[model samples]
Target: MKFFNEESDFFGLTKLKERFYSSDHDGLSEADREYINRIKGQNPFGIISMFIGGVSFAFGPIYVAFPIITIIFCFLTCGTFDREKEDNPWTFIIGFCLALIGLFMYLRGVVHELIV
Candidate 1:
């Protein structure tokens, strides 16, 4: 199924696929493009997600909020990085995995607490 019509771009949330989103990259070299995208800075959500994921993995037994927040930040990181330069949001991906592990640990701690 179809959730949204073809005429709409999910309320402009989805972008139409193209070679390049901006005309600035049309005549530039690969190095230039990379430089510009880098100057734009990394995705904040991704950075935060990674940091929080680490914290959750370390202290998940203390609180449930950490993993939940990390998961949210990981998903929110989509489309924040430049794809044209072959940039991968590995930080967010790793964060997502770490958060899942943290969540598992959290559940284990909860079970252990209950058993004791």
Candidate 2:
């Protein structure tokens, strides 16, 4: 069975593999190369998705797909967190919080519909 299509591996595993192996190391020693490779920047796409998803959640149940997309983006960008610290950590923090709020809002809306 085809569990994942081609893009799945490309967007997820391939990008992660490239990040791990593609460190600039010319005059630097092995240790320096390793150190540099260990650090990574946050994925801009993930940040954007979280922000947009959070905003979309405010629109109500009709736009439920937005929060789900945000969750997917969160998983896809999970690799970025492996580094020491992300750039502009507050963006991700705020985005993440908003995403959670969005998710809760979506859920609450769903439950309200089911109960009423």
- Which pairs clash in model 2? none
Model 2 gets an lDDT of 0.57
Specify the poorest-scoring 10-residue window by lDDT in model 2: 1-10
TM-score, prediction 1 = 0.55
lDDT of 2 at 13: 58
On residues 61-96, what C-alpha lDDT tens digit does candidate 2 reach at each position?
456666666666655554444335445445545655
Clashes of each: 0, 0
List per-prediction Cα lDDT, in the order shown: 0.63, 0.57
**Which segments of candidate 1 are over 4 A away from where they belong?**
1-41, 110-116
lDDT by residue (1-116, candidate 1, tens digit) is: 13333322444433532223445568889998878766534445467678888887766656778888878656654554555444468877888888888789888765235433
Total clashes for model 1: 0
